[model samples]
Target chain A: MFVAWRDLRTAKGRFALMGTVIVLVTLLVGLLSGLTAGLARENVSGVTGLPADRLVFAEPPDGRSPSFSDSAVSEGQWRSWARRPGVVDAAPLGVRTTEAAAAPGSGGGTGGGAARVAVAAFGAEPGGRLAPGGLAPGRVVLSARAAEELGVRVGDRVRLGPGTAAVAAVEGDASHAHLPVVWTALQDWRRLPGAPGGATVIALTTGEGFTAAASEAADEALGTTALTVDEALAAIGSYQAENGSLQLMRGFLFAISALVVGAFFTVWTVQRAPEIAVLKALGASTGYLLRDALGQALLVLTAGTLAGTALAAGAGLLIGRSEVPFAVEPATVLVPAAVTVVLGAAGAALSVRRITAVDPLTALGSAR
Target chain B: MTLLLDDVTLTYEDGGGRLTALDRVRLDVPAGTVAAVVGPSGSGKSSLLAVAATLIAPDRGRVVVDGADTAALDRGARSRLRRERVGIVFQQPNLLPSLTAAEQVQLMAHLSGRPPAAARDRARELLAAVGLAGEADRRPHRLSGGQRQRVNIARALMNDPAVLLVDEPTSALDHERGAAVLDLLVGLTRERGTATVLVTHDREHLARADRVLTMRDGRLTGA
Candidate 1:
């Protein structure tokens, strides 16, 4: 990288221009990655955070893709799952979105006065691991966001359906389908409008003997789609369409970044043809030239990506502090940056291959 | 003889016909000898250098550098031989713009996979020999035409190649600088005990050559 380093130092303007492009592309990818993860978290964190490894949903009609809105796991199906071999636990988790309002005289609980906020109401067995405070009849555990929206705390009353339930406690900030979750008993959840009488899905904890074949056998018998937590993300209708578009955009960005970097290096190598010929005529091997060129590209890509990543991380931290959903994990930030560098290098490699074809005899000022 | 070109013939395809560049040329340069080849434009001076440097394989016959037959070597071996035993100073200064005068010489060591640190002392000595001691750190653009050409000359010697091939080294320099460059080439050839072949159009530098060969119409004749 000796010549590569000197080249960078001497030709600062050309590399700087290309470096700036890489930085901007990386920044765009980083921000989008964070937003995609954050939005995805808001859409499925409630279901994903469940204690079970799999969520068993009622199979969609006519073999179409399964969806949370369309699934309604009957009580019999969950009981059968609980009795199945290798099934450690099968907990019924009901989910639905409904209006939430503060109770009168209990922490801004004015009926007809306080705003009614839409919330995803999740119901599990009273002592289930998901909604911890034992969801009893006429009582509910409100997620922090749900409680904040309703202006109510513990021991306060919030309206669910026609009747209201006393808030047992404000627990985690679980959400689903972009709405904060309100945890209630199965009985109380039945009263909410548009909620099926049975549970929405059955959360299953499988033993070591569990396998995809066994899961499929059980699903076929019980008329359900048994999917792991990550796989179940596609069951969310909005999540599928929204994430697909964003992901397509991300893919295009990666491709564009690779091509852009490749094109830049192509022109750069062409412009340095004379110098390359001179080096070759002076006994520089093709491999040496390739390494020098690639090293320069790698250095530029790494510097640009790191700077962009740091900037993106700072932006994510700032955004995470606000109400906007933005994830800043390794998968969301570092992965994208790494992919950009790898793809950019691949592009640069393709461009610099032309260096190998340069005729060393050209340096003698004549053609053979 | 360290650099030998035996019955060498090279031709180029042009418009469904072949134009000979070097026609059955035979040359040999023993170590510590300076051989000058003088020719006009298109007179096959560069072609002879190209063949001797192993940049191009002759159509017929062989190039033996440092007693190793280049015809038996592969592409990779040819390049290695060039780096290890052959040095070519291009017609133009052709210094990489990014490198300083000293670094231009150091680049040869880099190409040969020798440590830059190991070559630095030698590079300094060579640069001083070419009168570029103070201008070692100055890049090509900052150096005058003569200085860059001198750097080129110094770079070619850094590898201690057995065969040194110089192509029109002073073509781009003024008469005084050209003469100085020619003198440096002749003096280095003898001091380094290298087999030297200098190709040029200028007749004035013929005095410095141990033997002068005039090339015309794809043939060489002793002068």
Candidate 2:
């Protein structure tokens, strides 16, 4: 990088402009990545956080995707799944979004008015791990968000359908389809108004001997489809559409970054044609020239990406706690920065190929 | 032992027809001598230097630098020959604007894959030889015209090339600076035993050449 290094030092203005562009693009992509992960968490953390490795839904007719909104697992299917070989445990889990009103003299009474919180309620049977407090019939566990919204604590009664269940505990801040969770018994869940179906889906834990044959037997017996945890994410309708659009936007950002880099280096290569000719005449090989050019690009890209990543991470930390859904995992921040650098280098590589075609003979008279 | 061009004929495609730049031109310069090629505009002086420097292959001629025939060599081989054996001082003082005077000369060593530290002493010596010892750290834009041209000359010889090909080295300088450059070329040719070919249109600097060759209409005379 004899000339490349010196050019970078001497031509600071040009490279600064290019580096600014890279930084801004990386910042935009990184922020979007965080938001995408945060929003996705809100959409599917309920299913993803399940103790079972897989969830079984009532099979739609042939050639259709599984849908949580459309699935309703019956008791016969749950009993059949419990008897299947290689099935360590099968638990019936019901899910419904409904309005719940806290007891009049509970924490809701502090304001002297009823506090009705919208929550996604889950139902499981007695002795099943899905049950809130080990089959205490009238006890319910509320997620932190749900508890906060309803202004109820333990030993307080919250009305579900026609019955009032005592709050057992306020657990982790888990969400389902953008709403907080409220756990109740499966029988009590069925009794809730507007919850016409018995159970939404069946959560399954499979042993090591699990096989396709076992799956087929369970599916036939249960009359439900089986999906890995990852596959079940598509069952959430909003998650699919929202994640798809965010991913598409992220893809477009990557492409645009590449194009912007390509355009900048194309002009830079053209501007450096004379220098290339002189170097060629000075016996600099095509390979050496390319390495020098790409090394210069890597230096600039790495600097710009790191700066952008740090800025984005700081911004995410500031806003993640707020209402905006922004997740700041290593995968969310570092991956996009890495992609930007690789794609930008690839773009610059395409432009620097013009170096090989420069005629050293031109340097004899053209070097002015 | 220096430079030899044997019956070289170079042509170029011009407007769907062949325009001959050098027609069967033969030239030679032994070691420790300077041969200047003077011509009017478009008289193939630059073409002759280009062929001798191995930047262009002649249509029908052999270019022999230090007993190696470049016509039979591959592109890589030709570039290697140029790197190790041939040196060209361009028409313009084509110093990379980013490098200082010493760095410009040291770059020649870097191109040949030599360690930069190993080349530093030699770069300083060459710059001193060209009377640029004090301006070694000055970039091209900061140096005077004469100093930049001298740096250009120092860069060309840093590789210890057997044949030195100079093209219009004094084009951008005044007479005093041009004379100084010409004298430096003549002195370097004598001291280093390099066969030097200096291409120029200026008649005043002809006295520095051991032999002066004039070209007209793509033919050489008055050698």
Candidate 3:
């Protein structure tokens, strides 16, 4: 690090330029990661938050995959799953996206008229693990965002899809397909207009005896597909496409960061080749020189990445308070920063390996 | 003897056949003596120095520096030998632009795994010896051509090696500066008891050498 530290100090302009580039790239990646996670939470939090091991959806047409908008599990299927060996419990879950408005004369108006909001209505058995407490036939539980949007509180009346129900509670911040979720009774959901004849999907809690083979057999006999909570997230209509696009963008940013660091180090190593040869001739081992160069690169990368991540965290904190759906968690901040530094260092390692090929004899007659 | 080259032969691959760079070269320089080798362009003077410095291995025969046979050493061992027992003064100053004059000298000690504090003191002493005490903190770009060459000399002597290989030390200097540099090299060689091999093109500086030799067509002879 002796020579490396001095080199960094001596070449301030060049290193600072590269450092700024790294900082900006890291910032972009951090923000994008936060946005990706935030948007995903909005798109599938309702499904992911369910306290079930697996979700069983009605099998679609021969070539199609299961979808929440298209799947409908009948009572017979739910009963069969509950009776199957290794299945601890199976509860029917209804999901529908519809408009909810503050009931007339309920004093729930946002400004002058009754407030209307788009919501994902989740129907589950009353008092079940999937439903909020106090849910009943004439009552509903609104997610925090849902309650805020409809200008309603507990005990306030709201009209959902041609029926009216009193708000029993406001719990959780869960959403589905970018719409806040409102929990209601399965019977109430069935009575709504355009409602499916049965539950949209069956939430299942399996015990230790639920092997993959057993689940596969059950799925085959019941004409349904079972998925873990994470896999079920793809069943949501908007999550797969939105998450995939954001992830692809994040992937590109990581690639760009590596390439940019590689390019900078490549030029730097080439420019320092003469010095490397001189050092080698002066009895400095190749290993020593390589360590010095890599140490220098790590220093720059760590400093730049930390700065960028701090900036992103600060920005996300402010943006999260608004309705931008930005998450500021360690996974979104520190993980991206670590990835940037590691990838950048890998790029730099490839560039600095050229040091091994430098001939110390060249320093014999070569002019500076 | 501090440095000995016995019937050393070196060659490089050409398109069809091999080009002989050093042919059956034999030389010896004991400690505390200065041996000057003056040669024309392409006379293999540089090749002779390279063989003695252990930068390149001879195809045939032996090179012994401070009683260690370089032919028996691997690349890593040879590098360690150079770090601990040999010092090379390049034709061009070749001082790293990032380091100050003192740091350049200190790098030699660092390569040998010496403590930084001790290296610093040694570097300071050597810089003062080379008459660059006031300019120790100045970088290569901030120093004059003569000062840079002086720093190069101080750097090579930092480890106090048994063998010192100097190449064209006065090539870029005028008469007065070149004489002063040569004088310093001679005084240091005697004071330190180092086996010195000075390769040069100018014959004017040969008078100060304890012995003078000449190279031509890959052969050495008395000047």
Candidate 4:
């Protein structure tokens, strides 16, 4: 990389401009990746947090995929699922998005006033198989986010659909469809407005080594469809649409980064054709030239990408807890950086392939 | 002989037909001498030098550089042969804009798998030999035309090749600088015992050549 290194140093402005472009593209990709993961976590954390191997939903009409928002299961379906051979446990779980307000003139809230906070309520039997904690009637468990948003602590009176209820202990931080979850007794949940008078979905705990084929057969026999926890997240309407859009944007950014890098190197290699020819005439091998070009590209991409990813990770850390739902894991930052470098290098390879076609003879008789 | 072209024939496609650039050309340059080929613009002087330099494989006949038949060797082998035994001074300086005077020389050594820093002393020596010692760190754009040409000459000699092919080294210089370049070529050829072939149209600086030949219409004769 002797020539490659020197070229980078000598043409500092040109390389710097290219490096800056890579940095910006990588930054955009990194931020999008973090946000995507954060939103996904918020959308499905409650469902994923279920201690069940599979989630059973009521079959939809023809030509429609299974969805949590549209599916409602009855007590008969849960009983039939519990009677299956491999089914160890079948618990009725209900999901509903509603508004929660602190009781008027309550001393529990920090704001000194009752404000309606958007919340998602998950209903289960008290000390049920899914939650395992005793949840009596007229009380609800608030996730950490719910507690913070409502400015309410334990032992507070909260109003939910014409019922002023005492707050049960806020336990696990669970959320569904971008809203904080409130776990309540099955009886109390049935009394809330818009309650379908039954559980939304049945969480199933299958024996070890459970197979999808067996689950399919059971679903057919019970007039219900079932999916693994990972697959069931797609049933959340918000998760599917939101995640798809963000992923598409990230894909475009990757492609654009490759194209931008490719275009820059294409023009650079074209400009250096004469120099390459001279080197060839001096008997520098085609392999040697290729290594130099590729090495230069890799160097630029690595530096720029790492810098951008670091910037994104730093920014994510700064606001991860207070401002927004940003995840700063290795998957969110480093993996995207590696992909950017590889794709950028691939683009550069395509552009620099033109170097081999340069004739060394052109270096001989021509004017410089 | 370090450079020999025997019955070499070369042609290029032109106007929907073949145009012969060199027709059965024959030449030999023994080690420790300079053989200058003078010709008009289209007289195939460059073609002859190119064939000898192994940049072109004649359509017929053979090119033997340092006693290796380039015809039998494959493309990769021919390139290696050029690196080990041949050096070419192009019509233009053709210096890489990124490299300085000394680094230009060192690049040739690097092609032979040696570090440029390891060969820095030799690069400085060669640059000093060519009277560009003071311009060692200057890039091509910073140097004068003659100095750039001299740097080109120094780079060609960096690998200590047995055969040195020069193409119009002084075309871009004044008469004095051109004469000085010619003198340097003659002196380097004698001192290093290298076989040198120079292609040029200028005959004013003919005294330094041990022998001179003229090419007209793809034919050569003693001058």
Candidate 5:
């Protein structure tokens, strides 16, 4: 890398400009990745955080996908599933998004004032197999975010529809469809406004021996179709569309980053063609030249990417605390940086491949 | 101690046909002597230097430099031959813009897989031999044309090559500077015992060489 290192030092301004571009692109990718993960959490953490290994949703009609909003499981379905061999437990679970009112004296609330917070309430029988920590009647378990937004803590009386209730506990942060979650008794959940008076779906704890035949028999007896948990993600219409579009945009950004890096190195290699020819005439092998150029590129890429990753992490730390909906984790930060480095290196390698084509005879003339 | 081009022939593609650059050319230079090749433009003087330097493989003959048969060597072996036994002085001096006078000389050793820093003593000695001892730290852009050319000569000898092929080393300089460069080339050829081939269009520098050959239309005579 003797010539390469010298070239970088001699043309500091050009290399610096290119480095800055790499840094900015890396920053954009890192931030986008963080925000994507954060937004996804807001849309699915509630379902993902469930204690059940798998969520069973009623199959949609006419070949449509299962959805929590449209799915309704009957009590007969739950009974049939509970009685089946290899089915250790089965519980009817209802999900509903509603405006929650907090009692006065909760933090930041005036006397007799009501603070309404959006929540997706999950209902289950007290001590039932699918109950998360065994929720009971007249009491609700509020997710951390829901408790914070409603300014209510454990033992506080919160109103749901017309009835008043006490907060059982404040647990992990979980959301569904951008709304925080609340756990309540199944009977109390059915009394709430807009309640369909039936379970939204069934949560089953199936043993290893559970078979499709048994599921089919239960479905037939209960007159309901079933689907696995991962297959149920399509049920949230807004989540599917939003997540897909964001992911596509991220993919485009990655592609654009690679192309931009490739183009820069292409022009850079052309500019250094004369130098390469001179080196070749001086008995430097093509392999030596290629390694030198690639080493120079890696130096620039690593520095730029590290700076960009740090900036993204700092920015995410700040934005995550606010309402920007960004997750700051290793997957969100390091994964993007790693991808940028690999793709950028590949682009640089493509551009520098032209070095092999340089003719040393060009270095023989009176005008190099 | 040996540089020989035996009945070499080289051709290039020209307008969908072939153009002969060197036709049945033969030359041999012994160690400790400077053999100058004087020729008209387009007469394959440069082509002969290139062939002798192992930069071009002839269509039908062998270039043996310091006992290495270049005709049978692959690209890597040819490159190694050039790095180890052959030194070429380009016509334009062709100093890398990023390297200083000393670094230009040191680069030859670097290309030969030796530590550049380990060759510093020799680089400084070569620079002093070329009378650029006071300008060792100057970059190509900072040095005058003649000084840059001297650095070029010093760089070629950095690896102690057995054969040196110099291509019009003084073409870009004035008469006084050109004569000085020729004098230095002659002195180095004798002192280093290298088989030197100097290509030039000017006859004024021929007095410094032990022998002179003239070329026209890709053929050689008047040794």
Candidate 6:
């Protein structure tokens, strides 16, 4: 990379311009990745945090996908799954979005005043693994955010629809459809107005004998749709649409980065065509020239990506301290940086391949 | 003979037909001597130099450089041959703008897989030999036209190639600078014992060569 190194040093302004573009693009991609992951966590953390391996939903009508808002599984379905071969356990789970407020005349009221907040009510059996803490008839488990919003801790009374329950425990920062979760007893959940008769879905755990075919056969016979814990996240309508849009934006950013890098190197290679022919005539092999060019590109990409990732992580750290959800982990930071480098290198490689076609004879008598 | 072109013929696809660039051209240059070829603009002098440098393969006949037959070699082998045995001085100095004069000369050694320490020393020695000792660290934009051409000559000789093909080295210089460059070329040819082929349009500098040849219409006559 003797010539390549010198070229970069000699053409500082040009390369700096290109490098700045990469850094900005990488920064955008990194922040978007963090935001996407953060939003997804808020949308489905309640479902994803369940201890069950799979979820069984009441099958929708023809041509409709299963949805958390639309699915309603009865006690018969949960009992059938619990007794099926290879099934270790099955528990009924209900999900509903509603308002929760501090009960009046209770010591847990915020500043001795009433406070109301939106919450996702999850119903489960008293001792089921699907509940974070044990549920009881007159007590509820409030997620960290729900407890904070309602100003109610353990032993504090909170009013649900038509009833009031003490906060049995406050644990985890789980949410569903962007609302904090509040775990209640199945009996208490059904007492709410317009609540489902039985449960929203059935959480299940299967042993080794539960093959894919068996699961399919069981789904057909029981009139339900079975999905793995991860796959069931799509059942949240808001999560599907929001996550899809963010992912599409991220995809477009990647494509734009590749195109921008490709365009920069295309013009650079064209400007150096005469020099390339001269090098070829001087007996520089095609492989040597290619390696030199690619090495230069990698150096630029690595530097720019590192800088961009560092900046994004710094920004995410500051943003995370506020109300906005922004994650600053390796998956959010390093993965985007790596993708940027690899894609930028690929773009550069395609552009520099034109070096192979430059005719060495042109360097003989042609004017520079 | 260190460089021998045995009845080489080359043609190019011109429009719908073939244009004969070199027709049955033969030339020989022994070691420690210079042969000058003078020609009109399109008389194929550059073609002969290119053929001798292994930059272009002839349609018929063989190109022998330092006892190796280039026609029998593949593209990679030909490139290796050029790196090890042939050196070409282009019509324009064509110094890379990013490289220093010393780096320009050192690049030849790098291409041949030489050690950096040795290549650097050799490059300095060649630059001094071409009388650019103090100008080694300067880039092409900082040097004069004649100085740049001298760096070009030093670069071509850095590999100590057995065959040196020079193309209009003095085209961009005036009479005094051109004559001085020609004198330097002749002296270096004899001093390094390289078989040199110098192609030029000017007849005034032919006296410095051991032999002079003339080309017209793809044929050579005077020697």
Best by lDDT: 3
- Report i-RMS for every model: 1.2, 3.0, 2.9, 2.7, 2.7, 2.8
TM-score of chain A of each: 0.97, 0.94, 0.97, 0.94, 0.90, 0.97
What lDDT does candidate 1 reach at residue A319? 96
Model 6 misplaced stretches (Cα beyond 4 Å): A107-113, A366-368
DockQ of each: 0.77, 0.54, 0.60, 0.57, 0.55, 0.60
Rank by DockQ (best first) = 1, 3, 6, 4, 5, 2
Ranking by TM-score: 3, 6, 1, 4, 2, 5
Candidate 2 runs further than 4 Å off: A61-64, A109-112, A132-135, A212-222, A366-368, B221-223
TM-score, cand. 2 = 0.95
Model 4, C-alpha of A312: deviation from truth (Å): 1.7
For model 6, how does the per-residue alpha-carbon lDDT over B60-129 read when each residue is reduced to its tens digit? 9888999999978988898899988888888899899999999999999888899989999999999998
TM-score for each predicted model, relative to the true structure: 0.97, 0.95, 0.98, 0.95, 0.93, 0.98
lDDT of each: 0.89, 0.87, 0.91, 0.87, 0.85, 0.90
Give Cα distance to truth, residue A199, candidate 5, Å.
2.5
Candidate 6 clashes between residue pairs 3 or more apart in a chain or in different chains: none
Better of 1 and 6 by TM-score: 6
Better of 2 and 5 by TM-score: 2
Output DockQ, candidate 5: 0.55
Docking class of 2: medium
TM-score, model 6 to reference: 0.98
- Each candidate's B-chain TM-score, in sequence, is 0.97, 0.97, 0.98, 0.97, 0.97, 0.98
Model 5 ranges with Cα > 4 A deviation:
A79-89, A103-113, A205-231, A366-368
| Model 3: CAPRI class | medium
Instruction: Estimate, for each residue in A174-263, the C-alpha lDDT of model 5 and write its tens digit.
Output: 899999989999999988787766788888778887888877877776666655666666677778988898889888887887788888
